[model samples]
Target chain A: MSSTPSLWRRPFLPARILRWPSGKATPASAVYEHPLIVRYCHWLNTIALFILAGSGLQIFMAFPSFGPKIPQHDLLHVPPKLALGGWLGGALQWHITFAWIYIATGLIYVIYQFASGNYRQFLFTSSDIKGVWPMARFYFFRGEKPPAAESYNALQKLAYTFVVLLGILSVWTGLVLYKPVQFSGLAWLLGGFHLARVWHFAVLWLFVLFVIGHLIMVILHGWNNFVSMITGWKRNPDYLP
Target chain B: MVEPTNNEKLAHHLARRDLLRLSPLLLAGALFIPSVRSKFITGGLGVGDWLSEAIFRRNHLAPTFSTSELTPFDQFPLNTYDVNDPDVDFDDWALTVSGDVARPGKYSLAQIKALPLQRQNTKHICVEGWDVVGRFGGARVSDFLNLVGANTSAKFLYVECADDYYESLDMPSALQPQSLLCYEMYDQPLTREHGAPLRFSLPTKLGYKSAKYLTTLRVTDVIPQKGYWEDQGYSQDGGI
Candidate 1:
């Protein structure tokens, strides 16, 4: 498939570009799109998220049923195949341990994003909102040409921003569930433990959806995306700033 | 569209077609096998419990709350059986201390309450993810163990409740200062709705570990095989 001449059926769309400091070892010809700190946090997040998902599923499965009880009512339940943490004890252990890692890495990522001023690249401005429809059309409606510009497209910015907010919500809800008494005020603010639990579980499914979309987009974008994440530099000279 | 160079082609580990075909297999593996699934869910899970257990000192007490912080009574009612359950008989109740104790015998409620009494205001953490502060008055589990001359070397304290509920706590938790054989709540005799005659109030454990309507105490060297919910897959270490 790689040898099949054209990876894109149409001319490659231009993307918004951001210039970041390059490592001394990096060649001047290629742009350093992702810094080492970003790469490290991204990979660490991959580990933390996966563990949390499994253990969280395990915890959820202990009760298995959700929502108000009305006999014969259709309530959503996670199938056993999708659940992690074989037992309640095992799941709690996994969940608690990874929760620390997830929180730590998340903090570092936020700090670095702000410190390095890379956060600007993720800003979704009014213009970005206007661009969303066109971008959606370009992807879904085959003949439309994608908007050309810089580092990340408007849709990418919107999605990434939403995900960041979602991550924060997940952690907040998790804490409310984990220590309701200590965080009683916070729990009450979110409408109590049961409501917080529903949000937590729903956010998990949102993450699953996000993962699916992220993988598909990366695949469509080709090896440049993976290579940039892994190596901290874009391989395609044309794709670089 | 730009053509991919030889290096770029080689750099690609999977073609689009291959990824499409392999995705299903990856999903199935994640759903069935822990080892393969854990590749996606990677962490130091094997050492987590060990580390937590090691760091979780026996004397480390759960946070205490004031009487003001005590959870409202009507809001947090009895969880087990309702007030009318026939299984609980408070009128003819006696606590039988047996197994590895030096003196094995039955003691009435009046006799048990006659021992040195203590009161504690501690958080009652529930495993289902809620907590409340309540004042429990009773003999310290350690003191009761001593009264019965329980075998100090025993590994577990297996307790049975009149409600047919059973629980087993580890030796260390059984000896924790906060662990109590509670006979009173809110400075009043326990209501029938609560664990009437007696119950174990272990601040270190989740609500379930504090068995209500407690009827029997068995000091044993063998690790308890199962508790009512532990058999149903609840965490044995019900600690926070």
Candidate 2:
């Protein structure tokens, strides 16, 4: 079932996802991560992103100064560069290699979700959206947390939304670093080879931000959330928070 | 009794409301939460292959090399600059075998290659997190063991490279079908940069243990004589 490349051309998804329209309530269990294939993409993205974070950090440490190098390294005491290029004994290679596979896997994933109905019900919602203001009020203001998100919390919705949109950016920028000459247009769009690197370095930081916050949310919520994904078990109550 | 009944109803309503609010939170957790993002986070993969190595047997499988991310010109560490370098000789290179064998002596590259050639397509695992699907063609070390009638006493197979780097596989892992004394890649002799003369290719183990630049082999019952990574934090069984 996995081998055919043509399946990607016309991804198959259940009709239930297609039938639903946005804003109308779809039970979280009914549409949120129902298919095992979509769930697999979630797991793969989560894992691969963090792996990139760690290994990318190891590589980006090769140049620590963030944001344009306007003022020279002559004045400030800066962190020394770390290169997995050869230093971590090929960690960089593994990062890029898995990234290619990760990209392919995500392509399969998004294609499936887009073909199905959940993309509108779960992912594309902008009701409260995960804005910094809502996030702050949810945490500090003891607010109701934006009427309880459908498939994802507002914060999650925004984070994933941005990530989904930037999917091409991440892979392209990474490629510019991996093989600058091969994908010259990407490098050029990223503002030359050196500028592409600057963005690459910056994205690594963004990933770190997402991860630390992602973890805190997980811990605060507890194992009920964890068990659902691993076991594919969801309890049905009359209402969703 | 009426007052008490009224209080109980109020409490029940609150509890029911909480349950209503509790479920989506539960579902979200499953969709978003993951405990460990990476198994190779700390220092790459430490020998997880030991399990597969013990359970499965194949002396012919070989992982392809096109998958190996090209090492840049600046980063490629080529040990042998010229054939004439005094450190080694292609003609005189010998793979010596000792311990747990009826005949323990060095065999020249020609003699080793002269053994039966075996080939198979197997997965090459990288600790960094990618797998290479390729083919390796060479003679099975098991075939070599059978030829010389290796004594049953030898429980470990120690393969050492000319570079001081060393790795070992348990007798069971060593005897796997994908395990072979590989001499050819992509229909050409394995290059020196890729452990050319004759290297043992076990598709199941992570790339690190598949030592390149082969120089010697020893079959022993001892356990400490394992690959360098095993001596460090890496797990002893380097199976995929």
Candidate 3:
């Protein structure tokens, strides 16, 4: 654990990804792609999600109706029914309002992702689908890294792709459940109302898992990766043969 | 005899060695992913909406108005409504209660408000992130339920609006102590732009369940009572 890098693809699948730069004239390291626009949107997305999550929990606390358990009780040992008092209703409205913002930023991020043509790097390739073992053993057993590649590594690509698609699913489902009348078309497009909410909630846990893992990678990689996300400039590390 | 100047290489070699040494721990970690998640690893600077949002349910059974600090509220009546054609006046609005009840009729705003009233200040919470401590004055849904009369066979109350807006709750949820057929908000009658004339609120539910611009109540007994979300993927109960 101490010696190995913090984040590894683990080579879960059998396929191998394209290796690092083959015979490159320049350095054989990853170039930072997080530009200013992306950095700003990323930060905004983070803020929006945090507010949405906390407030969302409060909204749930307002109404302790379904499921065998409530997140509040599990986390705080304080039952929503008992802890929320009567104002839970108002708290729910506020949560809903911010939820809109969180959702809107998410929208902008998706549009930018597609429009920027950066999505190509995130998509899977035949090599990534198959060359994972070499990559994994290389990463784990100190074998060789694949040839220098483009944009995202297979692992990062897979994670990013899945998250973006999941974001769409969650939002679509959420809207249908949110305003069945005003967005009746969306509701029908999804299915009905209740079902949409179910899909939205289920996918929520996926992002939570993503968030947890994303944090681990940042800590392991150190400030270089994180600081660059904010300042949008990373002094490339010195490379040697 | 010289050590590698490249820390990453040394680190890599050391990591492989460590992994070989800590095979058992790695195996365990792989088996129970949650253990690692519980270790409190997080990314990003300590800032913004995403963090708060992480804790919230993705889709809210709540309304999404006033999303940003830059937002300005166009407040009117508590139960305000946006008229369908802009040709209608809100004061002439009425509430109609039907389905499995002794009485099924549209009671004008005055008639409904005159029946009974209660006023209390409470917080309005949204799933996004915000709260407002405002006073609500309105008739208890239970009182109105009693007026039309409750049937043992009926297990839910469906609130319908003029613009096809609709929401429903289990009889128990609808008749809960805080449930109301609200007419006044903050201190004034519901403005047309607000959900005027009257709106419905089940305090325990999210804002969406509040069903502004309420015009009718339909009582019925059914399983999987369909609402906007029920058709999507949200659970029908929507408690949490």
- lDDT (0 to 1) per candidate: 0.72, 0.58, 0.55
Every model's TM-score on chain B: 0.78, 0.66, 0.60
User: Regarding DockQ, does 1 or 3 come out ahead?
Assistant: 1
Model 2 error, position A220 (Å): 16
lDDT of 2 at A124: 40
After best superposition, candidate 2 residue A53: deviation in angstroms? 3.9
On DockQ, the candidate that comes out on top is 1
Provide DockQ values for all models, in the order shown.
Answer: 0.09, 0.02, 0.03
Q: What is the lDDT of residue B154 in candidate 3?
A: 80
lDDT of 1 by residue, B1-240 (tens): 999988788657457545543443454455467675444333344343244445456776666777787776655545673333536666778899989988889988887887889898887766754456788999888988888899877878998877677888877888888888898998998777678778889886778889888888899977566588766655566654
Clashing residue pairs, candidate 1? A15-A149, A15-A150, A16-A149, A16-A150, A16-A151, A17-A150, A17-A151
Candidate 3, residues A1-241: lDDT per residue as tens digits? 4665322322222112223564877544434556555665676566556545554455445333332221222222334443221243333333454455557667776676556555465666676766566656664588877663543456656777787787778667765544443354676676545455556656767878989877875684467667767655443422222
Instruction: Give stretches of model 2 more than 4 Å off.
Output: A1-52, A59-241, B1-87, B90-93, B119-136, B151-154, B189-196, B228-236
Task: Give TM-scores of chain A for all candidates.
Answer: 0.82, 0.68, 0.67
The DockQ score of candidate 2 comes to 0.02
Ordered from best to worst lDDT, the candidate numbers read 1, 2, 3
lDDT over C-alpha atoms for residue B220 of model 3: 84
Which candidate do you rate higher for DockQ, 1 or 2? 1
